[model samples]
Target chain A: MIDFERLRILTESAKYDVSCSSSGSSRRNTKRGLGNAEMGGICHSFTEDGRCISLLKILLTNKCSYDCQYCVNRRSNDVERAEATPEEICELVMSFYRRNMIEGLFLSSAVDQSPDATMEKLLDTVIRLRKLHRFNGYIHLKGIPSADKKLIMRAGEFVDRMSFNIELPSERSLKLLAPQKSKVGILSPMGYMATEKKQALSLKYNKFLPAGQTTQMIVGASPESDGQIIRLTQGLYKKFALKRVYFSSYVPTNEKNALLPTSPVGILREHRLYQVDWLLRFYGFKAEEILDENENLPEGYDPKCHWALKHPEFFPVEINTAPAEVLLRVPGIGFKGAYKIVNARRYGKLDFLDLAKMRIVLKRAINFITCNGKFFGTENQLAVKNTLLLTSTDSVILSQLSMFSNDEIRQSVLQGEI
Target chain B: MITFIFDGTKIGLFTCVFDAYYERRIPKTITDKQVQVGFYDNVYQIETDTQKAKRVSDCLKNCKTIGVLKDVSLALKSGRDDKFTVIFNYVKTVIDNKNLDVSKNFANESVLAFSDLIKQITYEVHRFKGFIRFEESVDGYYYAHFSPDNDITWLLMPHFASRFSNQAFIIHDVKRNVLGMYDGYNSAQVNAEDRQVTVYLSDDEINFKKLWQTYYKSVNIKERKNHRLMKNFLPVRYWEHLPEKQVEIASF
Candidate 1:
């Protein structure tokens, strides 16, 4: 068994990495292997911070060689260091997996000794877990940026997903905050993996990063607007075919660093960015359509509502006749709601009562939709804006007040408006 | 008005549907529990028959394009009192409008109610897949205990059976008194209304539990504590069985 203290140190070091999803890969268990990956991902537990603990996210070692100013495990820091062997990690994963304590392993490590050596250790651990241990569970490996491309690609064959963190968004921020890291060092590997993954897919190969790649950027660390970050995200998705782009709101771990902000960036900004990210991915929105190149996402409203309010000519879409994409743009109707409307309207015309029965949030959607040629919402745009703002903030206060209620009310409150 | 009582099994519920059609009398209420019958109300007891059940099941499967049978099965598994009436009314609608696509018509109250019930049951099944935690027993077998809102212990068998193909484990639903057991090669479910067994943990189980508890604590960023969101995902009912949520008392 791995020592308790070593596990704590390694886990604490890796906690700041925000990508914990085990989705998109559906690798099945081999003849005698232990586990398999589900396509929708399974979150085994949620921590006190409300983050999902899908995988046993831990580091092989916390010893570092880089001195990134925002990082707690920088080389200059005097934190206690520890390392674990490949065999020990394998044993720990197997035992925890058998007992259903975790879904799989998320193996990351600081640049211990050298980048090449650290990548070699990760590769060795995954290969042993696959070949010697016969474990077929999900494994998400962290890519060492400056390591050799060949070694990183070899490691990709054994894991489900991999990530390279672009901690600072801009090259200037990279130089100022993390002088040792470079934009080229991060983006080049992502480009190389994207090309390789495309080639593998063309040849009908399914072994190279079956879940594809993802990268994270610190939101409030350096000076980058939400619009700029989102455009960069769009480029990464279009260029590298990344599965996800995560944004971690910067939390101050080091004291009195002149380069980094002492006060932490609040999580509401992070939440707004995620809302905009969803719009870009699923809501048929372009980054430019959501916001300009420099303006941050508005704090008072969601991206979909923000876009809806700005284009007044698009208001009052016919609920019965609008296309699926138009319904998606309405303030309160989600993808599921739009689907239900499209299907249900095929049989008969949908009215406000039918919408309410379908659980569509009519409070916000009433302002944007006309049901059977009847409009119930206010015609004034300012009044509409105030109503939406009041309801949105009302939910926040309502959720807070109901925090001590019984389970059923709490569940509905958590489900939160359609 | 007439009341039809069943045996609370899938076949029993289907038999009620069979009798209702053949007798040509729509039941005011279909239930498995005993209810107070008024003087003007008619009461009927439903005896489960395989032939009648199969006939109704076959008609449902004939509309397999819409997966009516699947909806019926999942809806019946809910612990709700009105599940029988909800499914019966929806199945009647599908049969009444056999030529048209009635299942997609969410404007119909019966169809909407049935869809909502299925959604609830399916969401619970998905939640339990992650919420179920297993502990190693002394003999190297794994055991987990949970009390889900729906009778879904059996529904979880196929998922874990394929994932843990080489391991032996048992999942106990304390509320429903049912046990889903998988023994390396095959899986089965049994009733455990009066079953009792003492479980002794392996020597290393305590050590691993402590390690997991410690890891759970360390991974949380204190700067981003959001208990509302935590309770939203994890919920208070599930915290009872989770080892990480249990406060450890120091033992001498």
Candidate 2:
């Protein structure tokens, strides 16, 4: 068994990495193998910070050679260091997995000795877990940026997903905050992995990174607007066919560094960035359409609502006749809600009551939609905006107040009765 | 008003549907439990017939636009009291309008209620897949104890069976008094009312549990402590079986 202290140190070092999803892979268990990956991943637990603990996220070693200023495990930091062998990690994963403590293993490491050596260890651990241990569980390996391409490729074959963190959004931020890491070094491997995955799929070799690649960027670390971040994220998704782009709000870990901000970035900014990211990925939104190059996302309104408010021409879309895409653009209708409306409308015309029964947020969407040409929302744009803002804040306060109430109130809140 | 009483099985519910159609008397309400019968009320006890139930199920299956039978099955597993009536009405609608996709017609109260019940059951099954915590026993088997809001122990069997193909495990639903057991090669469920099994932990279980608890603590960032969000995902009800949430040794 792995020592408790070593596990703590490794886990604490690996905690800041926000990507803990075990989704996107459907690798079935082989005969007598330990586990299989579910397509819509399983989150075994949620931490105190509300993050899903899908995988046993831990580091092989916390010893680093690179001095990235944003990193707690930087070479100059005098934190307690610990390293675990491949056998130890495999044992921990198998035990925890058998007991159903975690979905799988998320194996990341610092630049212990060199990038090649670190990547080699990670590769060795995964290979042993797959071949020797006969474990068919999900494994998300963090790719060492400067590692040899062959090692990274070999590692990809055994793991479900791989990621290389692009910690800062801009190259300038990379130079200022994480000096040893380069934009090219982080992004090139991702590009290579994407191409390799494509080639493997074309050749019918389906075992290479079944979950594809993901990357993370630290928000508010250096000076980068939401638009800049969104643009970079759009480029990553389009260019490399990346699966996800996670934004970790910069937490001030280090002390008195002139380059680093002493105060941590607010969690609300991170939440807004995630909202924008969802719009880009699922809602068919473009970064340029969402925000300008230098503009940050507005604090009061969500990206989708803000967009809808600005474009008054799109309002009063007929709920019965609007296409699926137009319905998706409505402020209150989520993807599921829009799908429900489209499907339900095929049988009969949907009125406000029907929309309410389907659980569509009518308060925000009422301004944008007309049920059978009967407009209930205000035609005044400014009034609509104010109402939207007012209702949004009202719901927030209501939810906060409901938190202290009984389970019945909480259930009502969940059902959107409030 | 008439009440059609079933035996609380899928076939029984289908038999109720079969009776309502063939007998030409649409019951006012359908249920599985005993209820007060007034002097003017008509009560019919549904005798489950394999042939009649199969015919109704086959008719539902023929509606290829929607998986009506699947939805009925899931809705039947819900813990709600009105699940039978909701499902019966929804199934009757689908059978009556076989050409039209009645399941998509959310405007219909029966379809809406049935869909909501199915959604609740499906969501609970998914949540239990993650929330179920297995403890290693000294007898070289794994055991998990949970009290889910739905009759979903059997639904969880295939997932855990495939995931832990080599391990022998038992999932005991404390509330329902049912046990879903897997013997490495096959899975089965049995009703064990008021059954109790003492599980002695393996020698290494404590060590691993401590390691997991420590890891859980270390991973939480003090700077981003949001108990509300955490509770929203992993509710307080589920914190019972979670080792990470148990305060064994309070960290001062």
Candidate 3:
């Protein structure tokens, strides 16, 4: 049996990896394996940044070969190190799972020995878990970049998810900061995995790398703007049909890494990226519409609010009259609310008071809407801008205050209550 | 003054909306009776027309996506009494206008307001999915009771049936007094009054619950004790319905 000490260390070490969503996988139980990846509610415990850690999110070993500056397990950092045998890990996971301590396993590792050897150990652990121990619970294994493609492909068939971290957005900064990790090492595996998963899904085989592939890019680690990060996000989603691209706000874990940002990334920029990500997933707003590759998203307001301020004539839309699509564009009237209006408005005329009853943030929406042909907000562009700025400040204050509320802090973290 | 009192839910809301928008009927009852005074209170005795009700349902069903159906259900479950009817009626008018105008201009203030209510309702549905906890009864039936912020018991029915089909279950909406029951084969509705809250358990059922309770205890990371986080997402009130409460109590 793997000692509990090694298990905790390995799992906690892997917690920083964010790609843990279980939706895309369709693997089921076979006579040989003991578990399955059902699509229902076998969810990974995702954090505020949307990194999934619910599974036994851990690494086989924390010892590293490469000196990636942003990594906590970087070569020069001299942190305590531990490694587990494949048999021990398999035994640990099976025991935890039998007790229902975990729904699945999220196994990742640092570049120990060599990338090839690290990849082999990861594969060995999963193979032991599945073939030897009959431990089939959802397994998300990380691919060690620069590891051989044959090993990567063989590993993909056994595990549900495989991610190769882009780590930074641009190739130039990637070379500068993470010289040991190459762009090709990350992108090629992702591209190949995407194509293979598609082909597997089409052929109705348990999709090879069932949840497909996801990559994480550390924001503010390099000087890449939000626009560049988002462009990469959009391109990945469009080209790879990637399930999600998570943003980790760069917090310099290593003090010696001069290439890294000294202070933690402003949470608001992270918040903006999430809101922009929401636009990409639900609302039809493209990355190009929200920000440019050279420019960062506005820190003052959400992307929707910033976009609305840019276009003035669209305002004072009649609340009862606005189409669901237009209602979604209004900063406060979310996509869900827009659809509600489409359904409920069929019965009668709506007013501002009714909007309040629906729990919409009327303070933001009121400026842009008219209730029963009555306009209540400033039409003057300057006045609207000034009022919006004041409201934005208040919103920040509200945002901070709101986080501590029993409802906000708890439910938000558990359900990712955004 | 139309003294047309329909069911005290979204259907009631829709009925009031139909009378006012199409039949020019006035509301005799409201959450605030003062609003119905003078001009708002003037009564036109509602001539009950099933035709109008059918017409309203047809029009709503015609324009209905999965979203609007939820709004109607939410307003029903909201139990807000008369104003819910007011919101429902306003929403109907917006849908009709969509057929005519198909643009933002046609929806007006009331339509948008109705839409916004649907948005909050959807959030409630999403919250319900996470908050819901099933406890096995003595009769071997799994039961979950919730007083959601919005009326969405019916909306939550399909999710439970798909996720836990083999188990016999009851999802009760305490506020609306409605329950969605599934015997696995046929998932159907039952009134809350008919539900008997039983605690009797056979040996096998007790054994299963014990095993389930046993499994629930082992998974948590004891060191990362975020009790504040736990209590916040799941308020203390919900513990009464969960089978694993004693373990949580012991841990604390």
User: Which candidate gets the maximum TM-score versus the true structure?
Assistant: 1
Model 2 misplacement above 4 A:
A390-418, B21-25, B36-55, B58-66, B248-252
Q: lDDT by residue for model 2 over B1-252, one digit each (tens)?
A: 999998999998888888998999899899988999999999999999999999988888787448777777778788888888888888888877888877778777778888888888989899988888888888998989998888999999999999998899999988888999999989999998776656787887777778888988998888999889999998887777788888732432
Clash count per candidate: 0, 0, 46
Model with the higher TM-score, candidate 1 or 3? 1
Per-residue lDDT of model 2, residues A66-118, tens digit only = 99988899988889999999999999999888888888999999998788999
TM-score of 3: 0.65
Q: In terms of lDDT, which candidate is stronger, 2 or 3?
A: 2
- Give TM-scores of chain A for all candidates: 0.93, 0.93, 0.85
Candidate 1 chain A least-lDDT 10 residues: A392-401
Return the candidate ranking by DockQ, descending: 2, 1, 3
TM-score of candidate 1 on Cα atoms, chains taken together? 0.93
Tell me model 3's lDDT, rounded to 2 decimals: 0.66
Residue B25 CA error for candidate 1 (Å)? Answer: 3.6
Off by over 4 Å in 1: A390-418, B22-24, B38-42, B49-51, B248-252
Off by over 4 Å in 3: A26-53, A95-101, A128-137, A201-206, A292-294, A316-323, A370-374, A390-418, B1-252
**2 or 3, which is superior by DockQ?**
2
